[model samples]
Target: MGEIRQRFTDEFKEQTVRYIQEQTKTIPQIAEELSIPAGTLQRWMSTHRKFENEPLLDREAIRQKDKQIHDQELEIEDLKEEIAILKKAMHIFSKERN
Candidate 1:
């Protein structure tokens, strides 16, 4: 009969990676404590490193969106000013015709 394989949740894997990053313990020591293979823990750390740049990407995207919103607001203000000028011109022409 084959031995059953153990499964771990993504949350558990992420927490383990974080613990490894925050501590000075050796990989073998942590693996012994957690009763998992050191290679498995190391693999998790490798995966975490790959995704770590995601936050930086997210911040850059947010900055671009904020800039877009600011530009749109300025455009709206300019349009409003143009509308006011047109209204004043209409008033002036109406009085000239009276």
Candidate 2:
């Protein structure tokens, strides 16, 4: 006789995937703890958590990356302004030196 299979809810699958994401353990380890097939857990993660095979970053992670880029842009602009000021100062000092 074959063993019976169990079904899991969508919410439960999502939470399991999330737990996998937020923890340090391997998929097999988590699956073993939860008594689910590792392949089933991997499929749940890949299907529910990815887009076209690429993992999607969370909204807060995207926001933080955007903020980091914005800060770097501001820093570049500030450096450009400082360089322009320094060039003008050098021009003035060179004229006085002549």
In model 1, what is the error at residue 29, expressed in angstroms? 0.4
lDDT against the true structure, per candidate, is 0.83, 0.83
Best by TM-score: 2
In terms of TM-score, how similar is model 1 to the real structure? 0.48
Task: Report backbone clashes per prediction.
Answer: 0, 0
**Model 2 residue 84 CA deviation in Å:** 25
Q: Could you give candidate 1's per-residue lDDT for residues 1-98 as a string of tens digits?
A: 99888999988898888777665578899999999999999998888644442333357778998999999999999999999999999998889553
Quote the lDDT for 94 in model 1. 83
lDDT of 2 at 57: 53
Candidate 2: Cα lDDT at 62: 81
Model 2 regions lying over 4 Å from their true place: 50-98
- Candidate 1, residue 47: CA error in Å? 0.5
C-alpha TM-score for every candidate = 0.48, 0.50
Compute the lDDT for candidate 1. Answer: 0.83
Candidate 2 to native Cα RMSD, angstroms:
10.3
